[model samples]
Target: MRQAPSERGIDPHLHRDITELIEGLEFEHQEQERATAEVSWYKEHTLFFSLV
Candidate 1:
């Protein structure tokens, strides 16, 4: 009859603990992306190096 929030990309019960966890994960993911981008740029900027 009705689906839970988790099934729809949401979680109510987890709202208490999961909210904080997800927030941290979001931040971490963004940081990782930034780091990856920086590394990519360094590799590309190098004159004689290929890291990717």
Candidate 2:
């Protein structure tokens, strides 16, 4: 069965799902940035890259 669009031109459930998805993506982005920063710090101060 087909569904009708909400007043905002999208289904309300779809809007909700999209919002959650964006939030999840943002959270993951923040996590990756944090991890990268940590690794970058180690790379700058450690001998892990001296041999290369």
- The global C-alpha lDDT for each of the candidates, from Candidate 1 onward, is 0.64, 0.65
Q: How many backbone clashes does candidate 1 have?
A: 1
Q: TM-score for all predictions? A: 0.45, 0.58
Clashes of each: 1, 0
lDDT by residue (tens digit), candidate 1, 3-52: 88667865567676888789877976666667668765644234432253
Model 1 off-target regions past 4 Å? Answer: 1-14, 39-52
Best by lDDT: 2
Predicted candidate 1: what Cα RMSD to the true structure? 9.3
lDDT, model 1, position 40: 58
All models, RMSD in angstroms: 9.3, 9.9
Error of 2 at 1 (Å): 19
